[model samples]
Target: MAAIPKTHRRVVLVRRPPGEPAETDFRVEEVPVPEPRHGEVLVKVLYLSLDPYQRGRMRDAASYAPAVGLNEVMTGGTVGEVVASHNPRFKAGDIVEDRLGWQEYAIGGGPNLRIVDATVAPISTANGVLGMPGMTAYFGLLDVGQPKPGETIIVSAASGAVGQVVGQIGKIMGCRVVGIAGGAKKCGFVTGELGFDACLDYKAETDLDAALRTACPHGIDVYFDNVGGEISDAVLRNINTFGRVALCGSISQYNAATPPMGPRLMGTFVGKRVTARGFIVTDFAERYAPARRQMGEWIRSGRLKYREDVVEGIDKAPRAFIGMLRGENFGKMLVKLA
Candidate 1:
C-alpha cells in the first residue's frame, strides 16, 4: 500500500475576516490522519461543502455556532467513505456525513455520524439539497414564510443551493416566485431552470423599487431573505399586510470590511403587521427525514432541480470557497476530495 501523506491537506484559519475572506486567510498544510479509537471511525473524505454561512465562521464574532478556531481547519459538513473503524455500528465501506471540518481525512467519535446512501441522490446532496442548507431553506421558507395561494414569494440569492430550492418550492406551493440574484446568468437560471415567475438582477436593476413594484404587483406575502442589506430593504417596502419574512442569511454582510446595514425599512413590520423570524437549521434536525423525502420526490418528478459547482481538487478548495461568496458559483459550491 502507498504511504499516507504525513501532513493533512487542509485549510487553516490564517486570519479572521476583516471584511470578507482573502486568500491569505487560509493556509494549507499536511498533517497525519489520526487512527480511530474505540467507538470511532476514520473516514477518507470525498466531498466538502462550501457554504455562504462559512463566511460568518471566518469572523471571531459569536453567532449561532462558535467561529472556526484560529489556526484550525475551517469547519464544514462533509461526506466520506469509511476506511477504518473501531465502531461496531459502522463498516469500512459505509459512507457517512461528518462535521469533519476541512481535511482530506478525519477520525470522529460515536453518535456524531449518520450513515449515508450514495445511491439515494448523490453523495454531494448530503451537503447540498439534503444537507443543512437544504433544511434551512425548507423550514425557514415553509414554516416561517408561510406562503399562501395567490400570494407573491420573493427570495434573494435565488439561484444558489438553498435559494434555488426555495424559489422552486414556492412555485409548487401556489405562490408567484420572484428571485433576486447578482447577474444575468444567475437571474436566467432562477427563472428559466428553477421556474421562478420572475427574476431581478441586482446588478442590472437601476431602480430596484420600480422593478420590485412591477413583479410583486399583488404585494409580497413572503420574503425568504438570504442576501440582506439593500435587497432586503426593497422587499420590505412591498410587504402586504400579514406578510412573513424568513431571515435565512446575510451574505451581503459576511465579508464586509465594516459593519453592514440592514433593511432601512425596519418600521415596515409595524405598518404591514409582517412577521420576520431568524432560524438555525439544526433547530429542525428531527424533521430532516420528512423534508428530504419531499425534496427527493420533487427531484424525481422534475419539480425541483439541483446544481453543484464542484471543484476537482482539495488544494483549490480555498479559491472556490471565496468565489462562492462573490457569487461566482452558479450552484452549490463543492470541493471533490476523491
Candidate 2:
C-alpha cells in the first residue's frame, strides 16, 4: 500500500450565494487527513461527481435534503480506492463509491458507501452512468414516466447525465425519442450519436413549441424533464392526453435568487389528465442491484452509451459546477480528483 499523506485538500462551502454561485463562495483548503476509526475505512478519492442538485445544497433553504452548512465540505458523490480499513466490509486496494464530498481523502463506512466492481466498467463510471445519475435515469423514467411502446417521449436537457440515459432507454422501450438540448453540438450528439429520433437546439430554435410539434407530430406521451422553466412549458404545451412527466432537476432555475412563478400549463394538466411525479433516485434503492445488472448488460451489448465532461482537479469544481448550470458542459460533469 502507498503511504498515506498527513494532509490533503478539499473544497468547502464558505458562503451562500443568493443567485449564481461564484468561485469565491468556496474555499479550497489543505487539512490534516484523519485516520479511520473502528468500522470505518480511509479512501483516496479518484473522481467526484458534479451535479445540478448540488446547487440547491449551496442555498441555506429547506429541501428534500439538508443544505451544506457554511464552511463545511460541499456535498457530492465520489468514487475512490480504500487505502486503509478498520471495517470488515472493505480493505486496502478496494475501489468504493460513496457520497464522501469533495476531498482527496475521506473516511467511509456510511450506510451509502459500497464497494465498486472495477471489472464491470471504469471506476469513474461508478460516479457517472452506473452511479446516481444512471440510477436516477432508470427509475425516474421507468417507474415514474411509465413509458409504453410507440409513445413519443421528449427529454429536456437531453444530452446531460440523466437525460441522455433517459432518451436512450426510451428508444430501448420502443418509444419515439426527441431531445431538447442547448446548442447545435449537443443536439447533433443526441441525434447522430445517441440515436434519438430528432433533437431541437433550444438556443437555435426561434419557436420551441412549433419545433416540438413538428418533431413529435403524434404528440409527446412521456416528458422527462431535467432543465425546467420555459423549455418545460413548451413541452407541456404539446403533450398528449394522459401524458406522463417525470420531474427531475430544474437546472435553469437552480441558481435563481427567487423561485420563478409556477408554470402556466398546470391547468392544461387538468384537462389532459397528465401525470407528473417528482422523484429522487433513492426511492428505488432496494431495486438497484437488478437495475444496475440490466443497465450493465445494455452497456456491454452497446445499447446504452454515456459521455462525461471532466475537469482535472478539486480546485476547479466550483467553476465547472457553475458552467454546468449555465449549460456549458457537454455531458456528465465530473472532477477528476486523484
Candidate 3:
C-alpha cells in the first residue's frame, strides 16, 4: 500500500581485511532498490544475522563458499518481509528468510529463500535459534557427536549461538554437559540458566587444561567445537578413547592473517581413537523440516533456552560483527534493520 523507496541502504565490502575485519573494511552506501522479475520476489530486510562465518567470505582465498568481492554487498543471512513479488508463491507482507546480505532490499528467491511463520516464533529467530544456528547444533551434535546417556560432552564457546544449543541438547540427551566460555557472566548463564552441568571461564583460568580435567573427570565423550584454537587443543587433550567431535566453527582463527599454529592433534587423534569431522548446516538441509519441528517443541516446552544480542540499525552491523569475533556477544549477534 505504501510507496516503495527508489533507493535503499546497504553495506559493501570496500577492502579485504589483512586480519581482523575493521569497520573501515566496509562502507555503507545508498543503492537502487532492485525490482523483481518473473519467478522472483523483492524483500525488505528486517533483521540481518551477523555471524563469524561472514569473516571467511571477506577473504579472496578459496573456501566452501565464494568470497565477497570488493565493492560488493557483504554476504549475510537475513529475515525480511516480501514487499513485492512476481513469484506466485510469495505475497506482499509475507515474512521470509534468505542469504540476502547486508542490505535493506533484495530481489531474488528460489530454494535459497523460504517463507517463515512469524506466528510460530519471533521472525528474528529465523536468523538464530530456530534457524541456521539451531540446525547446526542439532545435526552437528546428534549426527556427528552422538553422545550416549551419562557420557560427558564439552562445548567450546558454550554460551554462544550454536554452542548454547549444542550444550542444551547434550543435557537433554542425558549427557553431562560442560561448557567452556570466556567470562564469568557467560559461564554463569551457561550453567545456571542453560542448565549445563558445569561451565569453565577460560578467560579467568590460567590453566584451561586443569579446569577441563577437573570438570570432565570422566573424559569428554563428545566435543562440540566452536572456537577452534587453543581451546580446541585443550579439549582434544581430555577426550576419551573413541570420542567424537563435531566441528561446527573456528571463530578464533577466522580473522588470522596466517594459519594458526597449535599442538599436533593427529597423534592425539590416533591414541584416543578420536573422530573429528567438520560440517556445515547445509549438509543436512533436507532434514531441516524435522529439526525445526523438534526445536520448536523444545522452545515451547522451555527445555531449550536461547539468547540474542541485537544491535539496532543496519549501520551498526559492521561493529556488531566485529564484536562477535572478539567474543563480546553473549549469545547470537544480530542487527535489527527495521
Candidate 4:
C-alpha cells in the first residue's frame, strides 16, 4: 500500500450563486488530513460523483436535504479505498462508497458508508450504475412510473446519468422506450447503442409536441422526467389517458434565477387522470439489495449498458460540474481524484 499523505486538496463552497454557478464559487485549498479517532476509516478518494442534485444543495434554502454551508466541502458521492481504519467493519484496502464530498481524502464508516464490491464491477460504478443514480433510475421508473410491458415510455434528458439508465430499464421491462435529448449525437447513442426505440433531438425539432406525437404514435403511457420545463410541458400535453410520470430532477430549471411559470396543465392531468410522483433514491433503500442483483444480472448479460464522462484531478471538479449543468457531459459525470 502507498504511504498516506499528510495534506490533501479539497474543494469548498465559497459562494452561493443565485443563478448559474461560476467556478469561482468554489475554493480549492490544501489542508492537513485528519486522523480517524474511533469507529471511522480514512479513505483515499478515487472518484467523485458530480450530479445535478448537488446544485440544489448550493442554496441556503429548505430542501429534502440540508444545504452545503459556505466554506464547507461540497457535498457529493465518492468511491475510495480505505488507507487507515479505527473501525472493525472496515479495514485498510477495503473499497467503500460514501458521501465524502469533493476531496481526495475523507473519513468513512459513517451511517451512509457502504462496502463496495470492486470485484463485481469497477469501483467507480459504486457512484453510478451500482449506486445512487442506478437506484434512482430503478425505483423511479419501476415504482413511480409503473411502466407496463408494451407501454410506451418517454425519457427526457435521455443521455444524462439517471435518464440513460431509466430509458434502458424501460426497454428491459418490455416497454417501447423513446428518448428526448438535446442533440443528434446523444439521440444517436441512445437509439443506436442503448437500444431505445427512438430518440428525438429537442434542439433540432422546431415542434417537440409534434415530434413526440410522431415518435410515440400510441401516445406516451409513462414519462421519466429528468429535465423539466418546456420539455415536460410538451410531454404532458401529448400524454395518453392515465399516463404515469416519474418526476426526477429538473436540470433545465436548476440554475434559473426565478421559478419559470408553469404551463397550467393540471386541467389536462385531471381529465386524463395522470399520475405523477417525485422521488429520491434513498426512499427505496431497503429494497436495494434485490434491485441491485437484478440490475447486475442485466448488466452481465449485456441487456444493460452505461457511459461515463470522467475528468482527471480534483482541481478540475468545479469546471466539470459547471459543464455538467450546461449539458456538456455526454454521460455520467465523474472526477478521478487520485
lDDT of each: 0.86, 0.93, 0.92, 0.94
Q: What residue pairs clash in candidate 1, if any at all? A: 7-30, 7-31, 8-30, 8-31, 19-255, 19-256, 20-255
lDDT per residue as tens, model 2, 219-266: 999999998889998999999999999999888888888768866888
TM-score of each: 0.96, 0.99, 0.98, 0.99
TM-score of 1: 0.96
Which stretches of model 2 miss by more than 4 angstroms? Answer: none
- Off-target runs (Cα >4 Å) in candidate 1 are 1-7
Candidate with top lDDT is 4
Give the C-alpha miss distance for residue 105 in model 4, angstroms: 0.4
Give the per-residue lDDT digits (tens) of candidate 4, residues 7-58: 9999999999999999999999999998998999999999999999999999
Ranking by lDDT: 4, 2, 3, 1
- Deviation (Å) of 282 in candidate 2: 0.9
Model 3 over residues 1-338: C-alpha lDDT tens digits? Answer: 56789999999999999998899999999988998999999999999999888988998987899999999999999999999999998999899998999999998678779999877789988999999999999999999998899999999999898999999999899999999999899999999999999999988989988998999889889999998899899989888999999998888898888967999988979988889999999999999999998998898899999999999999999988999999999899999987
What is residue 171's positional error in candidate 3, in angstroms?
A: 1.0
What order do you get sorting by TM-score, best first? 4, 2, 3, 1
